[model samples]
Structure formats: C-alpha cells, structure tokens
Target chain A: MNIIVCIKQVPDTTKVKIDPETNTLVREGVESIINPFDIYALEEAIRLKEKIGGNVTVLTMGPPQAAEVLREAIAMGADDVYLLSDKAFAGADTLATSYTLSKGIEKVGQFDLIICGKQTMDGDTAQVGPEIAQKLGIPVVTYVSKIEDIENGQIKLKRMVEDGYEVIETETPLLMTVIKEINEPRVPSLRGIMKAKKIEIPIWDASDIGAEGEKIGLSGSPTQVVRIFAPEVSKEGEILEGEPTEIAEKLILKLKKGKVI
Target chain B: MSIKIDLSKCTGCKLCVKACIYSAIDVVEKKAYINNNCTLCGACVSACKYEAISISKKKKTAFDEGDYEGVWVFAEQKQGKLAGVASELLGEGRRLADELGVKLSAILLGEKINGLGKELIFYGADKVYIVDSPILKDRLDETHADVLVQLIREHKPEIFLAGATSFGRSLIPRVAATLETGLTADCTGLAIDKENKFLLQTRPAFGGNIMATIICPNKRPQMATVRPKVMKRAQRDDTRSGEIIEETILNPISSRVKLLGFIEELSDKVNLEEAEIIVAGGRGLGKADNFKLIHEMASILGAAVGASRAAVDAEWISYAHQVGQTGKTVCPKLYIACGISGAVQHLAGMQTSDYIVAINKDPDAPIFDVANYGIVGDLFEIIPVITTKLKEINGG
Candidate 1:
C-alpha cells in the first residue's frame, strides 16, 4: 500500500501572545511546529503502514524551514519526506495552494490513500483537502474522526457532523481530512531521529511538480487581501471589587439595570 | 517574490513592520527587507504610507466578471427546517443587494422543503430557487454541490453566501471548486466595497489574532461562508412576496462515499444555541469535581452549561458543550464565564452574547476584556454567592 499524508508547519497559536497596549500579535518567542491536527494524520498513516505492511510518505508545501516538520514526521516513522517549496508557490490562497499540492502529489507517484489535517492553525480554512480532491477528480471526505477498517481496497470511517457523527465507507484512490480524535500521536524514538538526520529530503518546485506558473502563486490566487487590521478591543470593562457578597449584590443590581435578570 | 519594495521610497517608518503579523519585515539601514517568512498576505501594502510595496495581480480568468449578477444565499436545512445562519446570510445578502441595486436570491435543496421557500422570501430574498428531491435528502456533499452548482451556473450570482455550519463548510467548498471560483470561510464581517462594489469578506485568522478583509478580484460569483451567530438574522416580513422557481437538476452526481448512519449526541433539553443564559467553565476550574459548581450555578439560573476546549480536552466535559473556533459559536442573552481565561478561540465563539459576566481570580484574563461585568475572585467563592442570590430570587 502507498500512503501519502500532507502536513503544514504553523506557528503554535496556543502560544501566540498579543501586545497588551497595541492589541497586536507579539511574534517574539513564537515557535513553528507541525499543525496539531496533521500530527494525527501522520500518526494514523504510520500505524496503518505498520499494520498493512506498506510505506508512508509525508509532504509539506512551505518554506525551506518547513522541512523541519518533515523531519519530525520521519522521526515518527514515515518512510519518505518531500518538501514542495518555491518562490513561485508563494502567496497562494486555498484554491491555488491545493492546485499546487495536487500537482506535487501526482509527481510523488500513485497512491492508494491520501490523508491531510482537517485544517491548519494559521489558515483554519478546512477547504484545501476537499478542494485538492476536487482538483484531482477523486472521492473525498472531511472531518474523519476515526478509522474503523481498511479491507479489500475500501476504507470505513466516522465523519463528524454538527449534531453528531456518521459512519462512512469509501473506495480507495481516496482522500480524507482527519480530526484530532482519530489517534494519539506518538513521541519520536531516538533511533528514528538518528535515521531522519541521515536522509536528504527531495525538494520539488512548480516545474518539478508540473504545476503551471499561471496557477500556482499570487497571480493564480483569486482572493485578494484588501485590508488587514487588528480587531478593536472595546473599552476596559468595569471590574467590581469587594467582598464576594458585596460583589454579588453589585452584579445583581447591574444585571437588573441592564434588564438581564 | 510577488511583493517588491522600492528602496527609493523607503521611509523606515516601521508602520508596515508593525502591521505584519508574521514579523517578516525589518528595516535595515533605512530600507525595509522582507524575509521568507512572508506569505505575501499583502497586509504591508495597505500599511505603507509611501507606496513602497507593490504586488502583481493575475492577468486573466476563465470567465468575465461582468457575466455574474445578483447576490445569493445558500439556504441550508436540517430536518426540513432552514438553518438559522441561512436567515443571517439572507439578511447580509439583502444589504449587499440594496447597495449594488441587484436582486437577492436564495438557493435551497432538500426533500419536502418547497414550503420553506416562502420563509426564505420573507427573510429578504427576491427570488427563492428550490431543488426539492429525495436524492438531496441525505446531505451528501457531492449530491448537494452538484445540484447547487448547476443552479449557480445557470443563474450566475455575483455573490454567494452560506452559513458556516458543518454542512455549509463541507458542501460549499466542493461547489466553489467545481465552479472554479474563490470562496472564503468563517467570515465575521461582510460588506460591499464602496469604490469597487466588490464583496469585501472579513475573517479572523491565527485563531482570531488578526482580521483580514479579502476580495475575489478576478473571480466571478464571489463566494463566502459566515459563521452562525456572527451575523444578524433578517427581519421577517410576512406581507412581502417574491418569486419561487423550481430548479431542475439536469443531472445528479452519484456520491462515492456511503453514509451508514448518524449518531446523535446532543439532547434537546440543554441546547446551547437556544439557551437564554449560559454558565461556562474552563481549565481554571481545577478539576472535574469543581465543574459541578458551574452546573449548579447554571441549574439555579436556568442556564445551559458551556465549556472551553481545554475543559473538554481534559475530559471534564463533553465536546457538545465546548465553545471555541473548533466548537459551536453561541449567542445567548446572558453569558457567565467562570474560571475561564479567555483564549482568542474561546472568545470567537461567545463574544457576541448580549450580556457577559466573567469570574476569575486573575484580573488580567482576556475574558475580562469583553465582559460587561467582571468579578476578580475565586470562582468557588463567587459562584456560590451568585447561585445563592439566584435561589433567593427564585424562592421569592
């Protein structure tokens, strides 16, 4: 079995701090790590490869520093890693980004299954996986919370919905985006990290992946950023300071005045 | 690099540096240089006072932008009832329509949903197009996208909007991809650009750390999805009338994925969306046992219990009660956040509540920023007092 998993390197948003005075994101000390959701995708791939006797490949489309995440995946037991990086691929929206990734996936050779995180932390637009499937003309599903079985080239899983979840079955040459509930990602073993350091991962650009220049970057992206602004935080709210009972009385009176009680 | 900096015009005022979320720009020797960390988000372009930065746009597209007309709302339905976000999108679409002097249309698909067309019309749609069929009853992305895509192609809407629910998020992307148009997700603000008359879609990224306004500069049928509770619902006018067209599915696409069954987790009693008052807990509650205080307070006030992702991930509460970017966006009459240090994600979900009360020992918690009333004390101390006061009122 050939399994390819797509991942992204994102600044750990959980650690992102905002400047108290300016209300802007403070970038100091923020570290880049694999998107939390994609860790589940890579982990599930490695587990499947272990069970079914196959190989797992990890791919990321980012700057050269993004290769660090590929190394992390390799340490987690992926067989191969590829970095799709080029200036031509910069400034792409979900549509252009997915198109570039799809082209890169095609160059990685045929695969029975492809896995991707539901979304990235930085973007959080869960549109890329399905868009890639659409661009590639393959069956796709999103928000896969579990993998029930893989047999006879068919995969059964649970897809999360608003009210609950739905059990689904689909045939391979399939792509699915996974949620965090799928699996617990494992810590890399020392030996695996040693192995990853020895490997020189291949770098693919727009040309190597056969992506049309007109469809890969800023020019290819349809959405344009008209403006970017920090959402204004309103005036500092009144903080009631007193004993618990007095504060409770104050709050109740205010609620009554506001017609909330 | 798509962005080019003209050193001759460089002032090194550092305004663009302050505007960039990525910290990709730095002034060196009176000129600014962009690093690889930049994704060309174009935030710097607007921040520069000197016009030192320029970006290139795509020269051509598959279709002429003038071919599309009217503003559209995807009227999503569940169990034969229209989703609340549909009404909200229609309300927003109505504004855009009036601004551009164009028609506002609603595209609805479901079995036995023809009657709901009147409601769509009342909510400000000039035209309601229905594709009522059994094949679309199951809410398969491919089936629904196939039907909606055909209508969009035929009608040629200039702006397409939908409620950013699980169904909308899953289904609309496929339709956008099929039509080869641009689609923005989870938009919190929508407006028509005054000069360009383009739909300006504003959304939060980096978990609500920054806001970006995007436009489909070259794409026809500019599409976007606004999160539920983020926009106001249209005022229904029963006396208003509009045209309802029964759209024909020229061809139905068969879905490769088979849905076996749906398992419902939320009970009807404590529906967060419908709850008038909500008392929420977070990691600061310390343990699952302390969470009982939140439940007690909520029960006393006849409010629903809510949780942050941390509380849910720690197994103190079920995910159904989770409120954040990854969870449900809720707007209640009164929201009391207890022991919750507000993260941006958590704030994204419940900031729109009519009245907010926050209780925590740490006064610096971001939750205090949005609260109408704030109490700086241990939740254990403050909640019991509040609960007792509520009980006294209930007894009287």
Candidate 2:
C-alpha cells in the first residue's frame, strides 16, 4: 500500500500577539511550526505503511522555511517528502488552495490512501482536505476518530459524529481526514534523524505540480481579505465584591434597580 | 438591491427561514424563499440541515470617482473602556478611509462612554456616533442591534466591520438581517477591491483546513465580522483629532431585557485561552480516578488541566476543561496529553497549541506526531517521575 500525508506550516499562536490599537495580529518575528493536526495525518500514514509494507510520502505547500517540517516528517519514517512552493501560490484562499493541492497529488501519481489533518491553525477552515477529495473525485470520511479494521482491500473506520460515532467501511485508495484520536505518532529516533539530514526534499512549482494559472494562487482564490480588525471587548463589568451574604444582597439590589430579577 | 437565493437547493427545511430572528424567510410550496425584506445574515446556511441556502448579489454597482463613502465600526465597549477589538477595527477603518478618502467613523453605544469616544479619535476614527442612555449600559443583544440598525438606516455607511467575538457575533447577524444586507463572519483576511471598492472577505472553511474568500458584492455598506487576534491594531496618536456625533435614542427603557447586577469572574478560574501551559486528560486515562495523575502532572508543569470529550463525558472533568470543536477553542503554549487519543473534535479545540507533549503507552497514538515530545510509556508511571523531577528542580 502507498499512503500520502498532506501537511501545512502555521504560526506559533503563543507568540501571536494582537495589536490592541490596530485590531490585527502581529505576524512578524513569530516562529512557524507544522500545523498540529497535520502531525496526526503524518503519523497515521506512517503506521499504515508499517502495517501494509509500503512507502509513506509527506507533502506540504508553504514558503521555503516549510521544508524544515518535511525533514522532521522524513525523520519519523516517511519514505519521501514533497514541497509545493512558488511565489504565485501566495495568498491563495481555500478554494484555490484545494485546487493546487489536488494537482500536486495528481503529479505524485497513484496512492492507496490520502490522509490529512482536519484543519490548520492560522486558517481554521476544515475545508481543504474534503475539497481536495472532491476535486479528485474520491470519497471522504471526515472527523475519523478510530480505525476499527483494515483488510480485504477495505478499511473500517469509526467516524465521530455530534452524538456518539458511526462505523464506516470504505474501499482502498480512499481519502480519510483524521482527527487527533486515530493513533499516537511515533517519535523520530536518533537514527531516523541522521537519515533525515541526508534526505533531499523535492520542491515542486506550479508547473511541476501541473496546476493551471487560474487554479493555483491568489488569482484563483475567490475570497480576499478586505479588512482585518480585533474584536470589541465590552469592559463595563463591575466587581460585586464583599462578604458572600453582603455581595448577594448588593447583587439583588442592583438586579432590582435594573428590573432584571 | 436584492439578494439572490438559490431556489434549486431549497429543501423546505425552513431552518434558515425559522432561524432568521428578523422573520425574513417564507416557506411557500414547501420551499423556503427569501422575499424583498430578507436580510442576508446567512443564518439560514448555519441553520439549514439540507444545505439549501446561499447568498448571491443582484448586480455590481458601477463606481466613479468618490464612489466609496462612509466608514463604520461596530464598537463594543466594556465598563466605559472600548474593547481592544473595537479599537482594532478603527485602525483598519483609518487605512481604508485614507485609501478611499472617506471619514472613518465608529458607532458607540453604552452608559457613560463619552470618554471612550475620545480614544476612538486617537486610534483613527474621524467621527464617533454615540448612543448613550442608562438603558444602553449593559449589552442587551436585541436592543443594541435595534439601535445599530436604526443608526445605519439614518446615517448610511458604505462599509462596516465588526469583531467576531461573542457580542459582535450575536449583534452583526441581527443588524445585517434587519437591514436586509449581507454579512460574512469569522473572516481572517479583508481587503478593498480597487475596482468597485468591494470589501473582500477571507475566512477559513471546512473546519479550518482551507481559507475561503467571500464578497458582499451587491450589498450596500459591505459588511464583515473578523476574528480577534488575526490582525494588527494601529498606534495611538494623541495629536489626531475627530468629531463626535451624538444621537438621542427616544426608545423607552422598559423593553424585553434589562441589565442585572454584575458578577465578577472568579480570579482562580482557569481561562484556557490565556493559559500558557496545559495538561490534558483523555479516555486513555482508563477511568475517572486516573484524572488525578493528569492534575498532578499539570501541577508539576505549572499548567492548567484540560480534558478531552471522552474525559469530560465520562465525568472525569467538567465541560469547562473540555477542548474540542463543541467545547472551548484554545491555543496554549504547551499542551501535555496524558493517555489522550487525538480525536478530530478534540483536536479542533487545541491543535493550535504551540508545543504538544503526548504521554501514552501506545506508540501509534496520533497525539505523538503533533507533540513536541513523546513518551511511549504509561502516563501514570511517567507523571510521577516528572512531578518528582519538577519538585527537585524547584527545590520544594
């Protein structure tokens, strides 16, 4: 079996500071890390490879610095890594992004399974994975919390629903978007780290991925950021402080004054 | 101006028509349709179980020079001080105002907020629209939105923006619906299309995997609600000056709702949003009794305790500590996972945490890959060591 894991690079939110006056996020000086959700996809792919005896490939589309995350994935037992990078890919919305990623997957050829994280941090729209599946004309089982069985050219999964869960059995070569519950990812060993340093990551451009000009980046994206701002905080809160009984009495009085009781 | 409703997808579910607090949708022939009075709040989209509703504009308006006009930010105030998000919107308004050569304005509503209006000017608002009344002191969603709709109807703005917080989220949809306008929510990016001065709105979709750009092309006063912490705020310049336009609201104080006594939040209460480090427990903890291990580990790291839905549902922890799609959304610095299998619902809440540490006996736990550090051992045994090490490190 062959498996592909799609990942992304996102800003470390802890370092993310909101500029109070401007109502915007401060992006400069913030370190970028692979999206936490993607890590699960990478782990699941590797686990499938170990069980099925096949190659596991990790893919990402980001700036040059994003290559570091790919190397980390390689160290954790992925057989190959691909970085889809190009200036034209900048500011691409989810619709355009899914198109580009789908093209990148096509360029990589056939795979038994395509695994992806449910979402990313910087852009918390869990649409790209399913969109890619939609564009590729494949079935997608989202929010998969458990893998019940994998055999007979089909896999059984426990899909997480709003209430309880549902068990699904899908044919091979299907796309599965995983949640954090699938499986614990393995740590990269010292030996794997050594191999990762020597590994060469392939960088693909729009042409390399066969993405059309109208389907890859900002030009292809329908959504644009017309403005950015911080949320208004209403701070008119008064601290009802006193002894428990005293505070309760004062609160009741205020409530009566406001006619809220 | 009219809203384009895709009639083909109407399932007659009426979720949207019913969800519309403004009574905008009508179900005719077992199909929901938006009439002339419809507000494009997209509540129908969220409420629609059949995925029947979407917003469309009639036609693009041709713009000549000086076409773009009026700037408004839905200012949310707390205790007389303006919310940081409100100020952030003003900074954005200032830039768009400068580019379009329009006056940047803010609609302020609250009790004793005259002083807040001055700060708005320092931040970049050219004018502050004030609606001050004793009845308007606390945030009553219905009344506040009514005030906003009335003001926008009277003093029309070409563009409007609001923060996507709880208050802003509740208010914007109602105002947009009342005005029969289009509204986009939780936008991460916003821009002005130089061509028609169209407010370009970009937001994540499909649960945060992709960013989608949206536009209210036909709606006047192109409106959007942006998420807090996604944009930068402007610097305060005390030298800058602006005007204050105060309006007297004659509406009776006795309405559907009234402000009650203020209850201060408990200081020791864990705000998962502000917590730097968190130790989360999951179903892998075996039983509710094992949550003590999670709490002990959290104490060692000087972190807060978080629970997965399984843990929360199992009654091992309260819902407040649960992190997932339906629970609180958190982005802590260090998230320690103890016997926690990373479920997507759970991941949705805390996947943005900076450094994740997973301690589970199962080497294949999905939590490990996202974890900065992985300890392939029983958390029960591992946590005690960590606790001891921490105590020694602290000389306690």
Candidate 3:
C-alpha cells in the first residue's frame, strides 16, 4: 500500500491576534506548526504502512517555509517528502491549490491511496481533497473516522456524518479526508529524527509538475478577499453583584426571562 | 433569456407546475402559462417530456455579470426535518432579496420532503425548489453537487447561502468548484452591496481573531456557507403561502462509494448542536474526575456538557464535547462556563449564545467580560450551591 499524506503548516491560530489599530492579523510573533489534524492523517498512513508493508510519502503545497512540515512528517514516520513551493503558487484558493497538488501527485508517481486532514486551520476549506478526486476522476470519501479493513483491493471505513457514522466500502486508488477521531498521532523517536534530518526534501515548482501557469496561483483562483477587519465584540454582560446565592437566584430569573430554562 | 411555451405540444400534465420552483407557472384551461415570478430556471422545461417548454439560448461569456437573478438558500434537511440554520439563512436571505428587489427562494433535495417545502415558504421563502429522489434521500457530496450545479447553470441566482453544518460544509464547496465559482466558508455576516449588488460575505479568520469581508466580484453567483446559530431565524407564520416546484434529475449518477451502515459515537449521544443549554468545563476543574460536578450540574438543568480546549488537551474530555476554534461551534440558548477563563478560541464557539453565566475563582478571568452574569468564586464551592438552588427552584 503506497499512501500519500497531504499536510500543511499553519499559524498557531490560538496565538494569532488581531492588531486593534490596523485591523490586520498580528502574525509577526506567532509560531507556525503542522496543522493538528494532518498529524492524525500522517499517523494513520504510517500505521497502515506498518500493518501492511509499503512506503508513506508526504506532500505539501506552500511557500518554502512549508518544507518544515514535510520534515516534521518525515520525523514522525513518512519515508519521503515533496514540497510544491513557488511564487506562482502563492495566493491560490482551494481550487487552485488542489489542482496544483494533483499535478504534484502525478509527478511523484503512483499511489494506492491519498489521505488529508478534514481541513486546514487557516483556510478551513475541506473542498481540496474531494476536488482533487474529481479532477483526477477518482472516488473520494470525506470525514473518515476509522479504517475497518483493507483487503481484496478494496477498503472498508467509517465516515462521520451529521448524526452518526456511515460504514463505506470503496476500491483502492481512492482519496479520503480524515478527522481527529481516527487515531492518535505518534511522536518522533530520536532515530526517526536523525533519519529525517539527513533526508533532503525536494521542492517542485509549477514547471516541475508540468502545471499550467494560469492554473497554479493567484491568476487561477476565482475568489478574492476584498477586505479584512477586526470583528467587533459586542459582549457587555450585566455582571450580577452579590453573594453566591443572590447571583444564582438572579441568574435563574434571567434564564427564565430568556426562556432558556 | 426566457422560457417559451409550445402551445402545439402542450399536454397540460401539470408536471411543470410541480417543477417550477418559484410558483411562476400555472395551467389554465388545459394550457401552461408562465408568470412574472419566473427567473427562467428551466425546471419546468426539463420536466416536460414533450418539449412543451424551452428556454431561449443566448450567446454569452461564462461570467455574464448581468444575467444572474434572485437569491437562493440551500435548505439543509436531516432525517426528513429541516435544520434550524435553513430558517436562519432564509431570514438573512429575505433581507438580501428585498434589497436586490428580487425574490427569495430555497432549494430542497430529499426523498418525501414536499412537506418541508411548505414549511420553508412559511419561514419567509417566496418559492421553494423540491427535487425528490431516492438517490438524494441521504446527503452525498457528489450527487448533491451535481443536482445543484445543474439547477444553478439553468437558473442563475446572484447569491447562494447555506448553513455551515456538516452537510453544508461538505456539499457546497464541491458545487462551487464544479461551477467554477468562488465560495466563502463559515460566514458570520452576509450583506448585499447596494452600489454594485455584490454579496459581502464576512467570516472570522485566524481562529476568529479577525473578520474578513470577501467578495467574488467577477463570479456570476456568489456563494457562501454560514455558521449555524449566528444568524437569527425568520419568524414562523403558517398563514403565509408560496410555491413548491418539483424537479427531476436528468441523469442520476450513482456514487462509487457504498455506505454499509452507521455507528453512533457514544460520547455524542446528546448532540451539542441542538442542545438548548450547555455547561462547559475548563482546565481550572483541576482533574478529569472533577468534570462530574459539571456533569451533575448539567444533568440537573437538562443541559449538554461541553469542554474547553485545555480540558480536552489534558485528556479530561473527548474532542466531541470540546467547544472552541478547533472544536465544534455551538450556539445554545444558554452557556454556563465553570472555571473557564474564556480564551478567545473558546469564546469564538459559544459567544453567540443568547445568555452566558461564568463562574471562576479569579476575579479577572476574561470569561466574565462576555458573561451576562459572573460569580467570582471557586467553582467547586459555587457549582454545587447553584445546583442545589436550581433543584429547589424546580422542586426536584
């Protein structure tokens, strides 16, 4: 089973702050890390590889700094890492991003399965994995929470839906987007870290992947961000004053008034 | 472009009546007549087998900015019932439609859901599109996208809105991609620019730290998915009436993925999305065992239990119950925080709740800033007292 895990480096959104004066994201001091969900995807891929004998290759599309996540994936258990980084790839939307990633996959060679996190923290668009499948003419399953079995060239899995999980069976050469419920990701061992340090990650540009220039970046993206500003926080609660009992009593009356009880 | 009726081929089967989403078509004396409300969606044209109705072909570019009309809300339904967010989108969609001087319509796809179409009309929709098929009984991304994309291409609505539920989040993006249109996700605010008639889609970015107002200036139909409970639902009025048009799937494409069965997560037995009240815990609870107090208080109030990222990261609670940026965004009627300091990530998920009560030992916790009522005391001391008083109030 040759599995390709797609990962991304995202800003620690929790630490991200908005500059009140300028109304812009204060990203200068914030640290970047592997998108938390993608770690689960990588771990699932590694575990699958461990169970059945095969290699796990990690792929990502971003600026040069995104290679850090590739190294991190390798340290965890990925056998090889490829980075699709270029100025032309900047400012891509989900459509363009997925197209570029698909081109990179075509260049990287064959694979039985492709895996990705449910979404990226910054973009939060879960469309890429399915879109890539559509563009590749392959089948896809989203919000997969568990892999039940993989045999006879077909895989059975559990997919999360609105109310419950759906057990699905599909052929190989398929794509799936997994959620954090799937599995707990493993930490990097010292030996794994050393091996990752010695492996040189290859950077692929639009030309390297034979991608069309118009379909690789800002030009290819159909949507544009017109404006960004700080969301106004209108929380001015009536702070109840008094002893604990008094506060509790006041809260009950308020809840009744709000029809919440 | 406009729909043309062929009087010679007219059978007056009335199938077109059920196919017109806008109630824009009526049959009078064994003939079909197109009304003024029609946006030329061509559902009736497709439903007529004898080619009695046809839309005129117009040569134009893909981004013909002037051709699109009306506002549409994707009415999300689960288990044969419409989700609450559908009404909220209608509330917002009505405003946008009125501003644009266009009609507000809802597109519903499900099996045995014609009843929901009338309900949508009662909740501010001027027209409801119904596509009933066994293939559409369940929410599948590819099938739903195919049906929606077909309808969108035939009848171009200037703005499309859907709730950011699991179904909406999974489906809308695929449709948008297939149509080569732009889509903004998890929008908190949606408005129309009176000047250019463009949809102003505002959503929180960077973990709700800032708001980004996005616009698809060149795209024909601007698309967006809104977070549930953020928008107010339209007031229900059964006296109101509208049109329900049944549509047909020209070519039903079977999905390659086969669903065997479903497994309900034990931790999520009580869905947090529909819970009226939520009692959430934080790291200040000290240990996983301390969550018993939080659960006890919740049980007494008949509320669901939630946890902050800290508690979930500490392995005190399952991720299913975590409410934060990375967790589920909930908008219950009441949210009570115990020992929660209210990190912005945590607040982003539940700040929209109608009422909030915070309890913490620290007087300066940020949770108090957003709490409607605050108790600056140890939760261990305060929670049990509140529970006891609540039981007394309820005579339990």
Across A48-130, the per-residue lDDT of candidate 3 in tens digits comes to 99999799999998767778889899889899899998767766777788889989888878999999999877667677887
| Residue-wise C-alpha lDDT for candidate 3, range B1-396, written one tens digit per residue | 346899889988776775443356789999999865454434466557688887553333357777899999999997699898999999999989999999999999988888898999999999998999999877777788889999998889989998888778777877877777778888888888888888889887666766667777776788999988878889999999998888897988876677677677676345677677899999899999999998888888889899998998899987778887667788888899998999988987887787888988888888887787888887887788888888998895
Q: For candidate 2, lDDT tens digit of each residue in A162-209?
A: 223455666676777787667677889999999989988899999998
Across B1-396, the per-residue lDDT of candidate 1 in tens digits comes to 378899999898776776675678989987899998778988788778799998876456677767888999999998798887788888889989999999999998989999999999999999999998888887788888888888888889999998877778888888898887899988989998889788999988887777889999788899998877667789999999999999878768788888888877664234576577889999889999998898888888788889998998998887778887666667788999998999988987788788889998998999999998899988888888988987898899
Model 3 - which docking category?
Answer: acceptable
**Which is the leading candidate under lDDT?**
1
Cα TM-score of candidate 2: 0.48
Supply DockQ values for each candidate.
Answer: 0.62, 0.02, 0.28
Q: Best-fitting candidate, measured by TM-score?
A: 1
Please rank every candidate by DockQ, starting with the best.
Answer: 1, 3, 2
- What are the clashing pairs of model 3? B18-B246
Q: TM-score of each model's B chain?
A: 0.91, 0.68, 0.81
Give the backbone clash total of model 3: 1
> What is the clash count for each candidate, in the order shown?
0, 55, 1
Docking class of 1: medium
Clashing pairs in 1: none
Poorest stretch of ten by lDDT in candidate 3 chain A: A19-28
